[model samples]
Target: MKTELIITTYNNPKALNLVFCALQDQSRMPDRIAIADDGSGPETKAVLEKYQSYLPLRHVWHPDTGFGKNEILNKTIASSDADLLIFIDGDCLASAGFIERHIELAKPNAFSTGSVVRMNAQTSQNLTEEDITSKRVFDAQWLRQNGNIKGLSDSLKAGKASQSVSRILDRLSPVKITWSGGNASTSRSQLIAVNGFDETMRYGGEDKELGSRLLNAGVKGQFLRYSAPLLHIDHPRGYVDPEIVKTNRAKIEETRKMRRRWADHGLDRHISA
Candidate 1:
């Protein structure tokens, strides 16, 4: 299947650069890459332009309005023509076999969600491009020493192990499979079937709502938490609004109660245009 990667970004150029470096080291590269830019400044654009020659990049940008990640995501989804679409945030760096694992695990009428080892500010700031290219950043020991290894699960996720080990851990894991915007993959057709992400949503629980809609549409969820680990570069959450989160939670609850499938203000408008 033709695969495309959709990376969502705002003004964080440094983190995005690291993400690009990690993608350059992927075992299986996507056919195309789409950047869902949400009103970023020139610094982010400069980073995109700099990597244009090195990667298959297509920037889908909008004006510097308020938070509109889902809107930009919908626009990017509308523009993409790939069979499979992988989603990630700009602050997360993919492991060496990330793309390959996603492709190997891809299925019809289902979506795959993975996990991330969130780095502390020190780790995120000190990481060099060489660390990413050499993949030393993913080493469990290195993460423990230089970065913050939160728990045993984070170490297990980053460890270089056999596919069977990862799969075993995945099965044993109690975390439910959900649409993790930072590390997830799904069929483009399945996304279109649910009319893509809800534009009315803010940050929190927005991705989960989309996954709920997919379930309502008879699409299943797959777990890739142990198999496809990402190094999530941590940043401040100044934009997080408690009221918005509460509202999004209510929206998600309503979606579950009503078994909602299609998004009311989603991809159809862009696709039709």
Candidate 2:
């Protein structure tokens, strides 16, 4: 099955650049890519143009909603056209085979989640050969464009060995959740089933809520083992605004409670904290 990438972004051109680079690296590229731009500038547009020819790119913009990027993500996801949708943050980069793995298991009515490796913003902004070699960051410029994945951990190298005995014994999985916000995939039907994400969700908690709905629907999510990995650039360790975070957390808790109710009533919501 073919796939589509639905990436959400605002004014962050650098992150979008990295993400686009990663998308280029996929072994089997998507039929199309939908970018939900929340009022970016000419710089962002310029960067996107560089990759337009590589993949069919579709971009839509909403009047700046003033909130975080979650609402725009929902809108983008809703607007995308593909049987399989792979979602990633603008600041994160997926491994070369990430999309291939996600497409391999995408179900008509199930959501699949994968793992995220965080990189400090310093590493993200000023990435170097060391970072890519050490597996500290995902260098889209290198990994996506240049086929570079050197200097990764021995464990990762061991896990990804193409023709080693390690490949045989490495069947064990490392993904803990069937769904995570940073890197995940789902079918259009499964996402539309829950009416997409709660557009009202402020941010910071949309993944858990949507994942709950998947469980309630009895959707089977197959973790990509170690095959589907995402490198996340750390940004300030979450929200610093106490009030904003407090409010969002309260909403997040409410979302969790709602999922629990779904479980209690007639859903199979199962996501671990």
Question: Which prediction has the highest lDDT against the true structure?
Answer: 1
lDDT per residue as tens, model 2, 76-96: 765666778888777777666
lDDT of 1 by residue, 1-273 (tens): 999999999999999999999898888999999999999999999999889999999999999689899999999999998999999999999988899999998999989999899899988888889988887888889999875688888887887566799988877789876788889999999999999999999889899999999989989998888899888998999999999999999999999899999999999878964
- Alpha-carbon error at 150 in model 1, in Å? 1.4
RMSD of each: 1.1, 7.0
Cα shift from native, residue 184, model 1 (Å): 0.6
Clash count per candidate: 0, 5
Give candidate 1's error at residue 178 in angstroms: 1.4
Q: For this target, which candidate reaches the highest TM-score against the unseen true structure? A: 1
**lDDT measured at residue 111 in model 1 versus the true structure, 0 to 100:** 92
- Write down the lDDT that model 2 would get: 0.63
C-alpha local distance difference test of each model = 0.91, 0.63
lDDT value, residue 216 of candidate 1 = 90
